[model samples]
Target: MQITIVSGKGGTGKTSLAVSLAMTLENVQLLDADVDEPNCSLFLDLDTKLVAEAKIPIPEINYDLCTLCGACSSNCEYNALMKVPDQILVFEKMCHGCGLCSKICPENAITEVPRTIGYLYEGENKEFLFNFGSLIVGEELSTPVISQLKQLISKDKPIIVIDSPPGSSCPMVETVIDSDYVILVSEPTPFGLSDMKMVVKTLRILEKKFGVVINKDGVGNEELELFCQKEEIPVLLKIPFDLEIAKNYSKGVPFLNVLPEMDSKLKKMIVDIGEALE
Candidate 1:
């Protein structure tokens, strides 16, 4: 079973829940798909090695035999290419590497060159297999990095858990689309509830099976519970707010070690997901 844990926004205990679930389960493969800000490895103690480098093609213009006909610029959906009177400007960071600019160049002046966007690392121990991507600073695109990391996964594993990026954008969608079940982690505050709606909408649009895991459960959690009940969405599990867990997080420790009571609940959540899949 492939399971992805995501949140409506950042700092809502998404990684905490994912790490807890991964540590509680046996022989699971974990992928931290948040290339922009990957912190899952901080809590995991494993012998890690750089497995691969992720790259994307960016346009390289040859000005020798070229005329700035503006065809490439017009064809670019992302506005990555801009044609001035004497020069064509290429914004490497804005480029999606679609190769459309090169194909549409009438003078064949555009060529593609590989640019490194991120590095893929793999780590493992007796319990779980771990892999994550670390995107280069100031790189605007991350889908390619996430794609490369997904390609490196061994699909034969019994359970695969993904720690997805926050929000309902392309990166988050890419991470969750392949999962058999997605656990949307949320806090009890108003901000969490609002963003959760957006994520839930995205999941429905993608036709994905998902449930809610209320993290940092507290006084305002009833609002989230009411919303879930109204939508008829299953409330899978709740990780309560504890100062010790927060302290452990700050010290780069997995909270599962201290909160041993959550182990069975997390295991039961996995079983529930399996049963729902059936």
Candidate 2:
């Protein structure tokens, strides 16, 4: 099953839930798609092999091919190509790498060339497969790399845990695409509950079944319970606000192993989510 863990915003214990869940399932493939800050590997402690380095295709134009008749520029949806009186400029940033400009070019002047966007790593820890995709720091568009990473996943696994980047934006949506179920992780604060609503909307939009797991459950007031009660969304499992667990997390340790109840909860949570998906 492809179970993606996402949050409405960052700092909501998305990775913590993901890593803990990964440890519980044997022969699971764990994907850390938070390209900006990939902390999931901090806990996995696996040996990695370079899988693939992601790149986007940008159209390079040959000027001497004669006419700048504006056909290429006009066909570009992203406006990456603009035709001046005698010249055409390629704006790489705006390019979506669709190759439409190259396809529509009458003069055969346009050719697609790869430009680096990110890197994908594949590794293993015992029976579990660990893979992650990382985008370049200045990359404004991460959906391309994220999509590429999603395609590289091993579909034969009994279980898969994808650590998606926070929020309901393009990157997060792409990460959760084709998922069997989504585990929405959040805290119990107002910000957490508010953000949870946004992701819940995203789930409904995608028509994906999901459950919310309240991280740092006992730290905040009981408004989350009220919200869940009203919405009828199941509370999967609550990871409490414990200092030792925080310190262990801060120092790079798996909480589920230390707190045995969490492992059992996560296992049961997975079973419960599977039933919901079914």
Candidate 3:
């Protein structure tokens, strides 16, 4: 089963929880799908190797065969192509690599070229396998990188834990879209509740089964818990506010190392989720 751990906003302990959960599970694969800023490797000691380079096809115009007929420009939905009087200008950043411009070109001047957008890495120890994607700087498109990273998932692993990007955007959706279950980590604060509500709405639309894990449980009001109760969303686990946990996390330490007592709780939660899936 693939379990994606996500958050509505950043700095909600999403990665921390994901890493801890993966360490707690047996024979699992952990994928960090937050291509723009993958940090799950920081807490693990596995020796990782470069697995693959993530690439996306961008249009390369052949000026010799170009006619500037405006066919490619007119058909481009992303406006990546623009026809000037003298030549056709290709905006590489705006291109979605759909190949529509190349297909519609009258002179066959446009050709697709692979552009390296990110890199995928793989690491394994006795515990579990770890994979992550790192998006190249200045690359606006992350879904392609995430797509490439997910392709590395091993079919032999019984459990896969994905650390998704925060928010309800395309990157997060791409990471969790195929998961068996999603754990939405949120704080109890007002902003946390507001963002979590948006994620809840998005998950409902996608018809995904999910539950909430309230981090820093003691600080915020009970309104978040109340909202979950009203919505009939299961409250899976709560990590209380603790200074030591924050300190350990800042030092690149997994909370499970410091709070070993919570290991049993996490295992129990996974068991409960498995039963629910069955």
Candidate 4:
């Protein structure tokens, strides 16, 4: 089973909760799909070694062999290619590696070239199998990296925990897609409620089974709980705001490592997820 842990916005303890939950499970595979900013490896004591490099195909124009045709530019849905009078300008960052530009090039001037965008790392300890991706800085696209990370891992594990990126954007959707269940983490603030609503809407549209985990539970906003109740969504867990937990997390320690009592609660949450699937 693949359970993707995601949030509507950032700084809602999504990664922290995901790492802690993975720690509670036995012989699981933990995938940090937040390639733009993956931090799960920091909390793990295992040695992460770079296993593979994630590359995307970018268009390379052969100026000498071609005419500046507008066909390639018109075919690119992302507008990554611009046809000037003299040449075709390529925006590497905007390219989605669709190969449409090459296919539509009348002059046969466009060729697909591989560009390394990220690195995939893996670490295995007795507890669980760890995998994650680190996107190159200034890379606007993380969906490709997330896809490569998921594709590289074998789905033979009994349980797989995916730490997804924040928001209901393409990268997050890519990470959460094809999962057995999704766990949306949020806080008890107005911003949290708003973002969580958007994420909930996304999950509903995707028709995926999902639940909510309210982090920083002591905060004085009842709106989140009310919304969940009204929507009939299960509140799987409530993690109270703790200063020690914050301190440990800042130092790259899992909250469950400092507060071992939460282990049973996390295990129960997993059981609840299993029951929900049933």
Highest TM-score, which number?
Answer: 3
Better of 1 and 2 by TM-score: 1
Q: Candidates ranked by lDDT, best first?
A: 3, 4, 1, 2
The runs of at least 3 residues in candidate 4 whose Cα sits more than 4 Å from the true structure, single-residue gaps closed, are none
Clashing pairs in 3: none
- Model-by-model lDDT, in order? 0.90, 0.87, 0.93, 0.91
- Per-residue lDDT of 35 in model 2: 81
TM-score of 3: 0.98
Per-residue CA lDDT of candidate 1, range 1-278, in tens?
88999889799987888888999988889999999999899999887899999999999999995788889888899998999999999998889999998888888888999999999999989768999998999887888999899987776679999999999999999998888899999998889999999999999999999999988887474889999999999999888888888898999887787788899999999999999999
TM-scores for every predicted model = 0.96, 0.95, 0.98, 0.96
> Among all windows of ten consecutive residues in candidate 3, which has the lowest summed lDDT?
101-110
Candidate 3, 223-263: lDDT as tens digits: 99999999999999999899999999999998889888889
When 3 and 4 are scored with TM-score, the better candidate is: 3
Q: Is candidate 2 or candidate 3 better by TM-score?
A: 3
lDDT top scorer? 3
